[model samples]
Structure formats: structure tokens, C-alpha cells
Target: MTMRRTDVVIVGGGLIGAWTAFFLARRGRKVVLVEKGVVGAQSSGTNFGNLRLQGRFPGQYPLSLRAQALWEDIEELIGDRCEFDPSGHLYIAFNDAEREKLEKYAAVSESHGLAIEHLGAADLARRYPWLSGKAVAATFSPRDATANPRLVTPAVARAAKALGVEVVEQCTVMQARREAAGFVLETADGRSFGCDHLVNAAGAWAGEIAQMFGEGAPLFPAGPPQFVTEPFPYFIRPSVQAVDGTVIFRQIPRGNVILAGYPRTAADPIRNRAPVPPAKTLAAMRHLTAVVPALRDCHVIRVWSGIEGYLPDMIPVIGPSMTTDGLFHAFGFCGHGFQIGPGVGLCLSEMICDGSTETPLDPFSIARFRGAVAEDEKFRREFDLPAAAR
Candidate 1:
């Protein structure tokens, strides 16, 4: 196979891959970013762009706050509007069980020093008069924002290209073998490359890629279906989350409402080629109507679904693997990567380019599963929405 060389090679040119390429290339590292299909074709583009902190794990709060700070200036940094709407996000609650859980979540998250404002139903209604559905209490994070991921992915990718990073699209990675020097990589059409280091930002396919080096575990891919509504004027401001955060809805700059399903699809059909299920859309609509009756008049313009790699415990796997040399990873986002992807890229780049990371890597390490039990049930319980709560 023909061989190429670079200081670093990145697999999967989605939000994470492109961001890492941008940071590393900015550092003057010769970088190559590879994508099997169009950029942001998977979870990066498919999920609701709810950049919020209403219900993130406490360990993730700090990174999210930092990312939100960066997102405030993302348009200026990328030279294009990703439609950064800093309209904030709200998490609503109605009952004892739900209220108790939300209060705990708010307390734990607030302990992280986030500026979370709690509101009763009257204040919530006064703030968002459109929310006529059932809810007794709410919490808001003004730092939460939303963006058009489709536009942002390609835009930042263009920036990476202009910065001298080589980005290859529609090039499938067939095999990856660790070499004494670094790694010898191959593409589907027989093209090959030798790099001093590699970043496996391959999303759902990262675990599979990691196996080529006999280092990473085969990750579980969770496939979730999502739907978007037709254009509606002045509908939703900040993204909205269920008290337990099952259903997340946010309107894009173009005025289309994006509604997330309750029971997120799992990693079955490795890749999906069908429109979102009718039942899924209907379920999301029910949640929307219950929260914002104004949505009852809106029409669903489009529906789509994509699979993302998931770990057993539902946390993302980020950082270098223990078994491999000069290799790093950022995958298994399980529907939470879009907002954190860029900061994750920065952390990965720091780890790879500087031999250290200032960001805490404990919560995202791959080793969390070495001797782990089936903790997904607990993870689901901890983060599961009250509506979906069994």
C-alpha cells in the first residue's frame, strides 16, 4: 500500500475531529483528518443542538462551563455564525419525586459554582409565557446556548483546511496497525499513511478502530431517533429539558424546533438508513405539547436518527488507551458530545501535543470498565428523566 506521513492523523472528521485538527494545526502540527462520509453526518449533526448545563453530570460541569465560555466567542473564532443563541436553558419539574431529583441535581451542579437560577411556576410562566403545560418548578442556566451543528461542522472544517491541515472526505479507514515508529494506517482504496501519533475521534467506530491495535474494547453503539418541526416564529428561546431531562427541545436560528425522544434509541443497526419512527416523533410531540402547548399547531418538517458508541456505564470514553502507544480517543458521547466535543478536542490536543492535560481526565477514561459491573442501570437511574423513571 502507498504510504503517507504526518505529525498527527485524525480519524472521523466530525465536530470532535475537526476541532482537534484546528487546535493541533494551529500549533503548527502537520495533521490529516479522515472521514468516511460527509462531515457531521452522524450524532454530531443528527442530535438536537441543545448546548445546556441544566442536567450534566457534576464531573462534566466544569468542562461544560469552560466550553460555554468558548462557545460565546465561537462565531468570532470561526469567522461565521454557528447561530450561537445564548438564550439559556430550563429544566422543569412537577411532583415530589421529580422535584426531589431536580433539587438534588441542582444542588450538586450548583456546588460546582454554576449560576443556576431556580424559579417557581409563576415566575417560570412570567419568564416563558408560552410554557402553558404542566410544571410546578424550574431552573435556568443562562449560559446554555444552541447552534446549527450542520453549519458549524463544515465551517470549522473550512478553518482547519485554511490553516493548512489536510482533510480527506469519503475516505474510509480500513485498518490501523501500531508500528514501532508510531502507526501505519490504511484506507479502503489502498492509500496508506505513517504518522507519529493518531487520534481516534471516529465516534461510534472508535472501539472498532482501537481493536486493530489490540487495545480498545468493542464499544456499544446506541442509535437514537430525533425529529425537527417546521419553521415557527418566536417559538422557543432557550433549550428546554424535562425535569429529569428525558425530552430536550430547542429551536434553531432558522426557527425549527428540534425535539429529542424520551427512550433514546440504542446501538442496534450499527448505521441507520431510515427516517425516525412515527412513534418516536409522536412521543416527542406529546412531551412538547405538555410543556409548550404552542407546539400543538406546529408541523414536523423532518425526522432523522443516528448511532453513537456507548460504554456500559453511559459515560463518554476520552483520553489515551493504556495498551496502545501514541494513540488517543474521544468517543461514546451517548447524545452529550456536541456541546462538549470542542472542549474535549482541546483537552485531547493538549494531551497529545503537550504530553499533559490541564482538564480532568478521570471521569472519561476508558479504564473505568476494566473490572466494572453492569452499572448502566444505575447510570440510567441517575440521569433518567422523571417521566421515564420507572
Candidate 2:
């Protein structure tokens, strides 16, 4: 019955937990981060890696921008760039309706202090000669970027460890209960942790922890199907996405074009699996070729997916628990967590250490789930709700 005590215990090792641990450690807090598996082996490591600033939830701009600043200085902060590329993001519209959507999105982004360049068909053709002429309009965000998802979480975890945070991997928290002084977390391996504050950043599995505190969210698990083409000559500069949500692709400096398709695939968190169906892969290929005619003959080298939690409202639970003191949650990002991971961590650390953060996190409070959460329109378009939720 070895019991390790710490000032803070984070129950997930994905980007959010890693960043939170890092920030807490930087602030001189004795912290313990426990991960069921290796760091970033889940959604944090398998996402499309788009650090997109445009077309984000209006409420997320401040946080996203804050995270972007950290990312821009990543090498200085963590001594690793993790293949971050500020290649920008181009949102293309193939029809009038999609063009209007692009215009509106651009307006919203501009209002939020993001610079967006609206491009007409001719302008797009001139700027991106390889782009298909079918695109009637487009908007480009120069600050949008991409990074290697596989490298980020581990690098951040390593950085956290260098800063004196104890990172426990291959360990699962079997039970968590609040005590009078603090909280106690029991691990499957017969170790216990007592912490004054607890953070639930367990990705798709975080809802169960919330339930233990008498709070519940309509959080479901799903993953976007992703594919990468065999290395070809590098031509595409910016990450390209269709406004219609059919396909999004970006070419890395190494010449591989990584792409992600929508209508997220079903995920099984119990088994820790998110399989990419072959049919979905083929459809993604077709969509990719349709958008970029030059890639019509490109061969896909691999396909994959990762389990991610989705709330009905398509936002995340990112504030203190409603029923518990010293318990915070930052999960259910609905595939948009990567870019905001750092900011969420910094905010959580601020909340824990300074008692508050400047970011407006009221919209992400767990209290929102006390009432029926109206599904966001994007949720309907981006995911096939589970039968139980439907």
C-alpha cells in the first residue's frame, strides 16, 4: 500500500494533461501525471495536427491564440519543434453556398482579430497553381499551421519531466474518490495517490470521472479517419480544406500528403480502438483527388484514427467541477483539442494556483450540462451521433 502524495494529480497523459503538468511544474507545484498508456498515444498523437486559428468557435479565439503563441515559441520552450510548420491554412469553397459559408467564416475570424484573405477563383488559381479550378472562392489564414502529432505529446511530457513533474505511464486510475483533506486515486497496479487538486483530462474516458462527482455529459467517442499518401514531390504549401467538409489535406516538407475525412468514424474506448474502415479510406481518397486533380494517381501509404470524446454541443468541459472542489476538467474537445491544448493547460494551472484565469471559461463550465445541451450545427454535420445519444 505505497501511497504517493502530491499537490496536483492529472489523470491523463495526452496533450492537455501533459501541458497542464508542465505548467504546474513550471509554477513550482509538486505534480504527478498518471497515464493509462504511453503519453500522447491517443487522440493527441493521432490527430490531423492542424493548429488552425481560423474557423474556430468564437469563444475559443483567445485561448487558441494563446496556445498559438506557445507553439510559435515551442522550440525555445521545450527545445523541440516537433515538426511545426507555419504553412498557413486555405479553406476552399467549390460552390456558391460554400463560398458564402467561407465568407461568413472569414468575417467571424476577422472580427476575432485573425487576419483572413478572401480569394476569388482567379486569385486562388494564381496563388495556388496546383489547386483545382472547381474552387470558386477561398480564405487563407497565414498564422494557421501544422505539426507532427506523433512527436508533440511525448516531447511535452519529456519537457514536463525535465521540470520536476513525476510522469507515471502505463498506469490506470481504477478509482478516484474525494477525501476530507483532498482526493485519493487508486491505480490498477496497487499504488495510491493523494492530491490536494485533481485534473481529469482523460480524453474520451473523462466522462466516467465526472460521473463519480455527480456530473454527467453526453460525451461520446469518435475519430476522424486520416490517411497519408506515399511520398511525392512537395508542391502543396498550405493545408487545404474544403468548406463542404469533404476533405482536408496538407503536404509536409518530406513530401507526404496527410489528409483527414469527415463524418467521424465510430470509436470503442473500452477496447481502446478507433479503426478506419476501408470504405471510408477510399471515400477520402476520392474526395482528395476530386479536390486536387494532381493527386488523383497518388497512392495512400497508410490510414488511421484515434479515439476522441465528443459532446453534443461540440465544445468541451474545461472548468472546475460543479459538485466537487479542487476538481477540474478539460475534455471532449471534439477533435479541436490539439491547437488549444497549451492554453487549456496554462489556464488550468492559473485556476489552480491563482484561483482564476483571464480567459472566459464560463462557456465551458461543467454546469452547462446541468441543462439539455443543444447540439451545435457542426456536430450534426461532423458526426453520426451514437444510437443512445440520438
Candidate 3:
């Protein structure tokens, strides 16, 4: 068995892991990233690419704001456009209750310096004629956008490799243990590596790594269904989501309409592959058409899903481990990690390099779940989308 040592070892090759490796390597730290599959071959690569910030968790807004800045300059950093589109994003309301929710969210989010414009029925109809009449009111955030999930992670990995970061693919971490000096990780292929610091950016599988250090995070693996329609003339520009969070759809410059919402996909987490059933696809399309009536004619050409770690509170766990030193975690993003992935990578990097970051990490710390079941339940109910209320 070959033995290796490095300054840091990252346990996943998704967006956060790859970006962390890139940043660390750029800082002259010897970094090694290992992945069971190809980089970005999971949720980080398969999501709807909705880089939105309209309705982020209150505590996540600061970090999300930093992420938006990185997305704006991502091409310069990664050497590729990654299909980032700044056309904007819209949240529509279909009823009075939905409108009230939109208003409340807008009011709170705007206070945090996020620019959100409210549009009533008449204004919405005049601005976005493609929307269905059921859209009684809407909110628009010009800064929220989209990116090509399939491109971002791989591009970042390549960039990291160019910076001398070792990326090992098709290597599964068989075992991990903390030593007096640092941590040692063994792979299924009989490769052993030691690092002074470890990052658990394992996406859906992150809870497994945290458990190795005695951290118990109640993270559930979920595969959200996503589908894309056959190419048509491009009409929709900005991405759109329902106020109740039941529907989300966006149009790419290529005219392919990508859609996703909250119904979990029937997935086998072990294989990391989830085939979207016909009924689920149809159900998602029905929700789409309710928002954009013209989409009723669009035929979906493909469907897929990716494994994502969802916490009970719908927030990610990002901070130092509670039980171990020299260990950091950035995982369980629930369903909205794609939009804030870059910022997350940067934040983890800062914590490692400078021991702190300008963005606050108190809310996302793993310690929050240490012994607070009642608080966790309350936050879960508060953050659960209406679609999941059932």
C-alpha cells in the first residue's frame, strides 16, 4: 500500500470539496481530494443550477451574499463561464396566503440588504406575460441567477489540479481515524493518506464521516426530482419559483426548460443514481404549468435526480467539529447548496487559513444539534416548505 501525507485531506469531490482543494492549494498548502466517483458526478453536478438568493435562511444570507459575489466573478477564477446567467429570479404567489408569505419574506430579506422588488398582479402580468393568471403577486431579485452545475465542479477540480492539488477519483474512503498528530484515511484500494487537517464535504455521505468523530447529525439523504424539456424557442429568461416552494423552473439560453420542486425521488443512495419515475415527472410538470401555462405544451425529454443531505432544520452543518480538533465540516445543505457552494468553499478555506472568516458561522455550527432536540424540532417545522408539510 502506498502511503502519503498532506496538509489537508478533503473527503469529497463535489463543488465544496473541489473548491476547498483549489483554495487550499492556491494558498501553498499540500491538499489531497479523494472521491468515490468522478468529480461533480452527484448532486453538485446534477442540480437545477438555480443560483438563487430570494428566500435563503435568515442566518445564511450573509454567507449567501458572499457567495453571490464569487459567482459573479467565477469565470475569472475557474477559467470558464460555467453557464452563469445573471438574468435574475422571480418568486410568484398563486393565492392570498402565498402573497402574504412572499411579502413577509421580501420584507425580512430586504432588511438584510438583499434587493427584492415586489410586484402585484397587474405589474406581474405586465412584466412577465408568460406567467399564468394564477400568479397574483411576485418578487424579483436581480442578483439571483443560475450556473451550469455540470461544468462548475469539474472546472474547479481541474483548476485545483493545475495548482498542484492531488485529486484521486474512483477511490472510496474505507476507514478514517483520528491520531495524536492528525487524521489518517484509508481507501478501498489500499491507499493510505495522513493529513494535519480534514474536511468533511461528503455531501449526502457527510454524516457518516462526522460519526467517526462522535458527532451525531440527524441528516437524511434525499434525491429531489429534476427534468428538462425538449429544446424550444427561448422566452423565459429569469428563473421562477412559487411562493409556497412547490414549483421551480428556469429556461436556459439554449431553450431547454429545467424544472424542479420538493417531491423526493425514489433513489438508491448506495448507487448514487435515481431514475425519475414517470408519475413524479408528470406531477412536477403539472406544477410547472400551473405557474407558466405555456409550458403545458413543452415535452420533457429527460429526467434525473441527485443525492443531497438534508438536515432537520433545513440548514447545513459548516464549522469545526464539536468532538475533534483539526476537523472541519461543510455538508448537509438540504436542497439549496448549489447557489451558495462557492461561498461555502471560500468560508471553509478562510477558517483553515486564517482561523476565521468575515461571514458568521455560529448558526451553522454542528454544535447546534448537540443536545437540542426541542429546538431542532421547532426550527425544522419553521423551515420546512409547504410541499413538505404533508
On TM-score, the leading prediction is 2
Instruction: Rank the models by lDDT, top first.
Output: 2, 3, 1
- Give the Cα error of residue 161 in candidate 2, in Å: 0.3
lDDT of 3: 0.86
Candidate 3 residue lDDT tens string, 1-390: 667999999999999999889888878899999998989998999898988887777888898889999999988998998988998999998899988988888887898888999899999888899887888898999998899899999999999999999999999898888999789998998999999999999998888888888887887776788889999899998899886667889998889999985556545668777677678788888898888888889999988888888777778999899898889999988778888888888888888999899999899999988775333442343232343432
- When 1 and 3 are scored with TM-score, the better candidate is 3
Of 1 and 2, which scores higher on TM-score?
A: 2
Cα lDDT tens digits, model 2, 100-215, are 99888888899988899989999988888887788999999999999999999999999999999999999999899998989999999999999999999999999888888888
**Which parts of model 2 are misplaced by more than 4 Å?**
385-390
Better structure of 2 and 3 per lDDT = 2
**lDDT scores for all predictions?**
0.79, 0.92, 0.86
TM-score for each prediction?
0.93, 0.98, 0.95
Q: What is the lDDT of residue 88 in candidate 1?
A: 89
Candidate 1 regions exceeding 4 Å error are 266-275, 377-390
Q: Give the Cα-based TM-score of candidate 3 against the true structure.
A: 0.95
- Among these predicted structures, which one has the highest lDDT? 2
